[model samples]
Target: MIDLAPWAWILLAIAGTVVGLSKTALPGANTVSVAIFAALLPARTSTGALLLLLVVGDLFALLTWRRHAHWPTLLRLAPAVAAGLVLGAVFLAVAGNAVVRPVIGAILLAMVAITLWRRRRTTAAPEGAAHLGTTLGYGALGGFTTMVANAGGPVMSMYFLAMRTPVKVFLGTAAWFFAIVNIVKVPVLAGLGLITVPVLLMDAVLVPMVVIGALFGRWLIPRIHQALFDRIVLILTVLGALYLLIP
Candidate 1:
């Protein structure tokens, strides 16, 4: 088994809970979990361990929001996402976490800024659907960031915000997207020898916290107003991105 200090375990448990809450309620919040895990473990190992927990969280999100997914959007994003995943895999094979993390942080910060600017464009005509180029750009970046650092949530959250998706639809589509994407990453991580018995054992200890967080999210989501939810997500996204850039 991999050894960790007591404090590390506590941090991991908190991160697991945040992962669940992020999946079900706040899309961008799990960046905190990604930061915590990477801080406490080898970056590659942390990515694998956290992937399993994210899948568990994804299951909960899918169960709650299955009926709300918009398949056409998912389909439109697929090709670019696939290209990004491949690019990320190659990058991971060649690079280290020190390089990866900062890149992700920069991308997230830029996306947040772009999203906010898009929202403020009062004179822009309403685009009924996201532009193909926009979808591909965000999808590719989301896939790349997620593959390297588990930081896709905020990237995609910015995309959805720019698109002006309804809150429920945003959550629902994100739920489905992550669930499928996390599952796809499993074998890739396993091939890289990142997922192992020690990681699984650690995850087992942390999963109950994820369940508790998911339940809390279910209860809390309906209570948040749309405007407040939007602001909260954007603020958290910015904070998470800044945290990544700091070190």
Candidate 2:
């Protein structure tokens, strides 16, 4: 098993819960989980481990929102996202922990800005009719951020928001997008030796927490006010980013 202090384990459990919640209700909230894992573990190891937990969450999301996805938008994004993934893999190969951590922090911060800007602006395009340029830009950036730090939630959330996707469609589209991307990442991370026996062992322990969060998120979704919930997530994400950036 990958050894960790007691406190680290506690934090990881919490992060796993966040992962599930993000998958079910809030798309961008996993930025907090990414920061937590990165802070507690080796940056690369954290990425690999967290990817598994996110995959578990993705499964739940796929079940919950499977019928609601916007396939055309997904098709539009595929090429750019693939290109960005290649670029991201190259960067991960060369970057050290010190380099990766701050880069992730910066990406989180930039994603926050994008999300905030998206919230302020209203798009004229109808659903599933977003401009090609907008689709490609967000798709590429989402792929890169997700590959590097498992931090694509905010980027893609911004894209969906800009497209004025209905809540269910947004969640469904994000669910499908990450499910595909995270699975693709498994082999790449394994080739890099980031997904080891220990990482798998660790994820097995944390999987239950993700389940709990997903259930809770499902229950809370209808009752919660999204705007308020998003504000809270954004604040926590900023704090998490600042932590990684500082050290």
In model 1, which runs have C-alpha deviations exceeding 4 angstroms? 104-126, 224-247
lDDT of 1 by residue, 1-247 (tens): 6799999888889889888888788765677787777767766777888999999999999999988987888888999988888887888777677876666567657666765675566336345788888889989988998888787876787677667777778878988998989899999988887899999899999999999888888888878675776676668667766776777
- The backbone clash count of each candidate, in order, is 0, 0
As a whole number from 0 to 100, the lDDT of residue 242 in candidate 2 is 91
Question: Per-residue lDDT tens digits of candidate 2, residues 35-68?
Answer: 8998888888889999999999999999999999
Residue pairs that clash (backbone atoms under 3 angstroms), model 1: none
Q: How does residue 136 of candidate 1 score in lDDT? A: 91
Give the Cα error of residue 136 in candidate 1, in Å: 1.4
Instruction: Give the C-alpha lDDT of model 2.
Output: 0.89
Query: Whole-model lDDT, candidate 1?
Result: 0.80
Which candidate leads in TM-score? 2
